[model samples]
Target: MDIVLQQMHYCLTDDASNWLVIAISALLVVLWYERKRIKEAIKQDKTH
Candidate 1:
């Protein structure tokens, strides 16, 4: 019983870490896309 509980705890920790990594990656993607859009807008403004 103790070993099973330990295993479960380990699995939970691993899943939590994986979720954290995924969230960070998604945030970075959004930031990168926003930055690109801002840059384009600036370029357009300069042209006008």
Candidate 2:
């Protein structure tokens, strides 16, 4: 029982890591948006 629980825990963590990587991969698709956001924030700070 304990071994099965341990295996399940590990599998869940592994799957979670994969999901996190996939989510982060989507950010790469919007590289321009991220750059634009950063540029705008910098411009705003300069104005302030």
TM-scores of the models, in the given order?
Answer: 0.95, 0.60
Candidate No. with top lDDT: 1
Q: Residue-wise lDDT of candidate 1 within 1-48, one digit each (tens)?
A: 999999999999999999999999999999999999999999999999
- lDDT per residue for candidate 2 within 1-48, as digits (tens), equals 999999999999999999999988887768878899999999999999
Please give the CA lDDT of all the candidate structures.
Answer: 1.00, 0.94
Give the 10-residue window scoring lowest on summed lDDT in candidate 1: 1-10
Q: After superposition on all CA atoms, how large is the RMSD of candidate 1?
A: 0.5
